[model samples]
Target: MARESFAIGTVRIRPGSARALELPITRLVTGADVTLPVRVVHGRDDGPTVWLDAAIHGDEVVGVDVIRQVMGSLDPKAFRGTLVAVPIVNVLGFMTGDRYLPDRRDLNRSFPGSARGSLAGRIAHLFMTEVVAKCEVGIDLHTGSDKRSNLPQVRADLDDPRTRELAEAFGAPVMLHAGIRDGSLRHAARERGAIVLVYEAGEPLRFDSYAVEAGVIGVRRVLATLGMTDEVSEPPARPSRECRSSGWVRARRTGILHLDARLGQEVADGERLGTLFDSFGKTLNAVYANRDGIVVGRTEAPLVNSGDAVVHIAS
Candidate 1:
């Protein structure tokens, strides 16, 4: 069967074969014409449409690498459904090496955005309308923000059977049953009856090869699960323990923080995960996990204030 042709603004592209296209946006102050870059691979046969988006937080580059590698390696002739890949969603923030847009708005928190709103909002709206609305399933890739690092994991509302199936199919090392945050893409997509998996890994502004490879493998696994591609050899055994709940372990006293644990490390109840020390090298307080769980995320910067989250544990 012949593939359908579509246009995002003035950019016209066909989808049966691998194609890279750009949807132009309004000109920015830097005089550079902003655009959303998308790569589409549509198979000749009809099947489920899946959209894989990365770099929603501009500083998260691991997903960008994964998208690149996945796109470069995929064969459209072998695919059954449409695979839309958006490598960088927040262009301004990506250019600045920051998580938020130049206007200080987080693109991830601006979903279901308005046609008439801030730059971030407009971009979010464009994505929701142009990319997301077209897909039956989505994989929104992300990484830890600021100075924090996250182990490769899938965060989703596993309460839903469909969502759980997708999360399991993702094959990440860990799966966290996280609540849907307001204005998040997953939340917005759920409202539209679409199941989207959020894959978190590495840290902002840094690329981890293992994390990238894992992401690529996970995405392909999802495609296979959706019948978009033939099942290849099974992926590596998933160290993936499912977490029923997760939360941040915050500091009780202000001081220099010293972390004794790493992402993906297991901690016991009341375990000393880190220590806070004064400028004079005197111990101020010891940080402990209140419950036994795996350290899914941790702050990399040593400085901390009272009430600051130092670790994120999932049980």
Candidate 2:
């Protein structure tokens, strides 16, 4: 058998070898060109090519560590197919710890980007052309934003059998069937026939050990499930729960919030999840679940405004 080789931009990676390459995006104010860093691991054995990208939202940094750990564990000689790991997708936002690019556009919503478009759009287009389009599957990692913390969970279009299988194989604590949002990487990737899974966990800008561990393990499990590798570093400790729908429990009035329910905890419909109290200690309101489900996400910040989302329940 002949050795297989993969190409991304000007870099060529042969089977049983690995290479760290950069794809140039655009120039900054200081005339410095920004680039996307990519690590390509081309296994000797023939199999599927998968891409793992994290930190599309610069503040969502947990996935960066997850990808690092995952990359450390993979060996090209023993692995199958190709593994493309990109720890940071939004270079500008990541540099400044902002969720959006310098242009204030959400990178997650600028997929299938155009070369002549905005910064986010160009980056998205570059990613789609140089990375995502080269793979058969993808795993886009993310964390909750806006002071929110999410229980380790996989959100994907469960209607697609292949995608659903990968989601189940990911083994996050919970799986939510999410729809494709316009301009999202998930939406663009699927349109191009790549089975993708979006893993959400932890909180933006803050590291959670459990969420990080779950994410690392989930990516490996999905790799095993795809036959890209037979080795799974850590099997899921518990079975994953599935939900077809979810809604947020919002605050009725602005105040300091006291949450009673925890992530991954089951809650019944109308159960009190938390309370809001004004500065004067007056009870403002009590937040309750609208349906029976697991508490998948909640705000960690104590201060909130009226109608702020407090809890996310998947039923």
Best candidate (score: TM-score): 2
| Candidate 2 clash pair list | none
My TM-score estimates for the predictions, one after another, are 0.95, 0.98
lDDT of 1 by residue, 174-235 (tens): 99988888889998888888888999998889898878988999988888889988885777
Model 2 bad stretches (over 4 Å): none
Candidate 2 Cα deviation (angstroms), residue 38: 0.3
Q: List the residue pairs that clash in candidate 1.
A: none
Lowest-sum lDDT 10-residue window in model 1: 6-15
lDDT of 1: 0.87
Candidate 2 lDDT over 174-249, as tens digits, reads: 9999988999999999999999899999999977898899998899899898887886766667778989999998
What CA RMSD would candidate 2 show?
A: 1.1
